[model samples]
Target: MNPNDRSIVALVMTGHGLVHTYELSIPIFMTAWLGELGVSEAALGAVVGAGYFLFGAGALPGGVLVDRFGSRRLIAGCFVGMGGAFVLLGLLPGLWGLGAALLAWGAAASVYHPAGLALISTGVQQRGRALAYHGIAGNVGIAGGPLATALLLLAFDWPTVAVLLGLPALLAAVGAWRTSFDERAAVGVHDAPDAGHGEPSPRPDDRAALWTRSKALFASGFAGVFVLVALSGLYYRGMLTFLPDLLTPLVTVDLPIDVAAGRYVYAGLLAVGIAGQYVGGRLSDHARTEWALAGALAVLAAVAVVFLPVAGVGTAALLAVSAVLGFFLFLVQPLYQATVAEYTPPEARGLSYGYTYLAIFGVGAAGAAGAGGLLQIAGPPLLFGALAGLALLGASLSGGLAVRRARVGTHP
Candidate 1:
């Protein structure tokens, strides 16, 4: 990669990692929240879901902001918002306080996926490999965030950890300010009439024009892509939210004797996701992204169906299920990301990704509450079954998208 491409990816990758670091870290802290806050799983789940819901729900406007302003500026703003939110989390440290901080975080983090992914889709030359590397960075944060939180809990309290975690976001904001790169270096201004000079063409002023843009985008098979991502998100959030708690009982082998075993297993699952993202991103470059997405979703469905059964056999069995769960879980991300790039117009890419996350994180936020309630009442088998059902639905949708792409030809 040239210096500019490297710089752009580095900025985005770091920012992406930090976003998820804070994201995944919340679940780890939730473990403490259970006892500290004196809330039932169902109640805490709703609270967590509310925060995540806002995080996703805000992406629509955030995408508009990205198009109106620039990704760099919005990304900087995201860092500030997230950092400040975490600091607030440190101060409040109550159930209501947690919800408020997460709401702030959701609003802040909602800016990232659209801004960062739009930058990559527009800026990078080697889009596929760049996405692969970018996804790896995210996996690092996803895996490391909880691990870091778990490790810190061994020493400091959750409140202090929340404050310490905020530091990285502030640092990333500094990096964003210092970093320099051409945002539209790869795709160029000519390819995007409204999208050159590091700014999008002015957004449509009237509802009719806005509707026209949305209609055109969905007509291009992005509708399928959107639904696919939502399904994937449902499974993603449902599986991840309570995974540490769920695995706590299954852990038999001895560890550091200080930390909760489930937290490490959770981190390890995310660690394996690094490879999953690499392989998925690489595959997207070589084959139709939708096709690869279908296959991955299929594997996920199988794993979800078998997860509880496989996990119950022994510690080894549990670890085995966890590893597969981790790998294919993240593999879906880049595939859907690449598909969004292929299926949407470059000028409205921000809006496109906005809807994507709206589906994934917003609608998918329901999974947190759903998983929690189900786990409390119906237990793991039912929870895993519900997850498997969602994955199967996603796989079917992806398969349809793959077939649609085969018949219709690639999007412009």
Candidate 2:
């Protein structure tokens, strides 16, 4: 890719990363918010879960807008919407107000997957690596959200902290407004002998082509991939949402120390996954895509077996297992996302990514709610067991997809 392409990728990534940090502030500051608002635990959980559900629900329509309008405009709108949502949340009064604010946040957050992924697909030539960098930016944002919330909460109340979260989105909105990219614009409609350089053609009647290719892939093995990704999403949300809660009690340290230390430890572990994303990206750029995904799944399976059994595992051991788990789990995200990019035509990139992320966010929402219920009943052992089972099934499903993808390549 040239300097201009690189510059565009960076801008899109910055916007995406900033958007995530703002969207996630609610979960990061949930405890503090609940204390200030005097809400019950169950109510807080429900509200947070609703935010995730709304975020997923909005993705399909967000994709439609991305397809109709352009990534740049959609992304710019997302930034403004998310910033406005956070500002609303900061100024709102009660639990009802919180719910309304989260609804807006979810709707705004939904714009990222379609807009950001479409930007990378259209603006960059080697999309695999570009997508990986995008994933890295997201993970970095994920890590930063809690860290920022933690720091801000110390100085300001939940409302002020929320208002502060809006700053990044406001800045990103400005940046996104200035950029432009259109897949059809870059590659014109031209009929010629195979451009032996091996690039997917820009489809004529772009929207119709998008529908055709996306529908075909959905009917083919793509459905199976969606199931695997949904399960992967559930496992991730279940594990991350509950892991610290589960581990904190087992720690012999003070409450403040345990929560504080655990948060950073988990964030550090998650940071390792950035490497995983980059590795998957580089491998997908050249190798069969499934290999990178399979590697991640296999590692996650092994991590589950070792880490899930012991409830009171020491800090050092927890750190080690968490790092490996994070590496495998968070890393597979880009690989799955890139699969949508590689399989569909460029015109459908936005819709394909939209549906993929919809599955991810939807499953994650269910996992978040169901995990809370399960934790109450069977405790962490059963919960981890169930998640591990889901991971195992996802692995089997991914293996099947890989074999089928290989066969299609050989015969075609």
Candidate 3:
């Protein structure tokens, strides 16, 4: 990336990583919540699901804010909000506390995707490479969060660790406010804010205009992508919500120093996902995004279908399956992100991403509660089966999207 694009990616990278750091940390904390608070997995999952739902649901308005204001302000606000939410977690330390903290974090975090993706898509010249880097940073946080939380728990208590986790974002808030970059560097002259003579950017503040903008957005074949995103989100949420706890039993074996076996494995799985994200992002720039994403989802479905059988095998086989699952789980993200860019115009990128994440984390967050209930009633086998079904549906939608675009000669 050139200097300007580097700056934009850096800002989004930092903010994105921190967001997932707090996000994935919740499950690690869930282990402690289960031990200390005496809450059932089903109840815990539901509460956590509520927060994640808001995280996605808030993206719609956040997209509007991104278009109206710009990414920088919203991101700085996100940093402050997430930091404050974690601080609340430290202070409260109860079931109700978890719910409240998560909701706060969700609201604060809701703007990030719209803000970050809009910034990158519009501001950065090299959108694909920038997204790859962004996805890698997120995987870092996704892996790092659980690993850090697990390690910290070995020394300090959960509350102290929570506060410590909160501090970094507080510091980042200052960095965000101080950082400098352009919001429309890559935009055409017509889309540039300072353009003297061109089509003015849409201000969808009025109800009729807002409705028109939204209607045109989904009608642009983004609706197919939305279905895929919702399925992907559902599978992601359901699979990860109780995965560490679920894997804890299967992965139990001798280790030098004591550790949460499942947490470390989960972290390792996500660490492996870093490569997946990279591959997906690079492929998005070259391959057909819909087709590539469909292949990834198919592989993901196979992994989910065989996950339980793999778990029954030796530890090595279980770990191998986990590594593959994690890889494909995240691999589709950048592809879908790129797909969104293909379907939407630059002027509407914010709203497009808003709806995108809303599908992924908001509506899809039901997977958490659904997984918990399934785990309680049937077990891992049935839960994995349902997850496989979600992946299959996503794969079909993505393939259908590819076929439709090809037939219409819009496969760019």
Q: Per-prediction RMSD in angstroms?
A: 3.6, 4.5, 4.0
Ranking by TM-score: 3, 1, 2
Candidate 2 lDDT, 256-293, residue by residue in tens? 43243444555565667777766765666776666667
Clashing pairs in 1: 55-106, 194-201
* Cα lDDT tens digits for candidate 3, 161-249: 88899999989999999989988898872234321101123447777887899899877787788888899999999998888887877
Runs of candidate 1 with Cα error greater than 4 angstroms are: 1-10, 117-133, 174-207, 345-350, 403-412
Off by over 4 Å in 3: 1-10, 67-70, 119-133, 178-203, 345-347
How high is the CA lDDT of each candidate model? Answer: 0.82, 0.68, 0.84
Using TM-score, give the best candidate's number.
3
Which residue pairs collide, candidate 3? none
- Could you tell me every candidate's TM-score relative to the true structure? 0.87, 0.80, 0.88
TM-score of 1: 0.87
